[model samples]
Target: MAATKTRTIEQLVAEYAEPIADAVGLDVDDDDRTLSGFTRLLSDAADMLSPADCTREWLEDAAEALTALGYVDTDTARQAILARVDGLLYEAKSDLESC
Candidate 1:
C-alpha cells in the first residue's frame, strides 16, 4: 500500500487564490501582497476551525489572531464572535470577502 500525499494548506490555497479571485471580478494580482494576505487569512481561519472546540474562549483565541494580523479590528471581531454564538455566521462562501 502506498501512503497518500496531502498538500499543505498554504499550497492548496495558493493554487486557487488567483483564478478564484478573478472569477469573482476581484482585480487581485498574484503579487506578494495578494499572496501574503491570502495566506495569513487562511491560516487564521484554519486555526479557528478545530474539531471538538466551540467554546467562547476558543472563539476569542481565534478572534485575537485575526486582530493581531490586522485582518479585523477588535470591534468587528467581537461582533463576529457574538454573531457566531447566535448561529449567524459566514463560512467559506466568498473569496473576495477573504481579501
Candidate 2:
C-alpha cells in the first residue's frame, strides 16, 4: 500500500494566501511587514476556517492584526485591506453555509 502525504498547516496556508491576495489586487512582498502580518493571520485563521468555523470576531481579528501592521495608512487603504481580508473570510463563510 502506498502512503499518502499529508500537508501541514503552513503548507496549506501557503497554497491559499498568495492566490487570495492576487484575487484582490494585493501586491504582497515577502519582506513587507503587512505581508508578514497577513501570513500570520492567515495561518491563525486556518484552523477556524478549515472546518468552516466562521465568525465576525475572526474577521475582526484579521482586520485588527492587519491594521496593527501599520500598513493601511489612509482610509482607502484600510478599506482595501479589510475588503481583502473579508474576501478571504467570505470564502470560508460561504463554504460553511453550503455544508
Best-fitting candidate, scored by TM-score: 2
TM-score of each: 0.28, 0.35
Tens digits of per-residue lDDT for model 1, 1-99:
975344332443455444433533444444513435654443344354444534323333433443343454566564554344222112332322454
What tens digits encode model 2's per-residue C-alpha lDDT throughout 15-89?
Answer: 545654443334545542345555554544453443445543454455455555366467666555545555555
- Stretches off by above 4 angstroms in model 1 are 29-36, 39-99
Model 2 weakest 10-residue run by lDDT = 4-13
Clashes of each: 0, 0
Clash pairs of candidate 2?
none
Q: 35, model 1: CA deviation in Å?
A: 8.1
- lDDT of prediction 1: 0.40
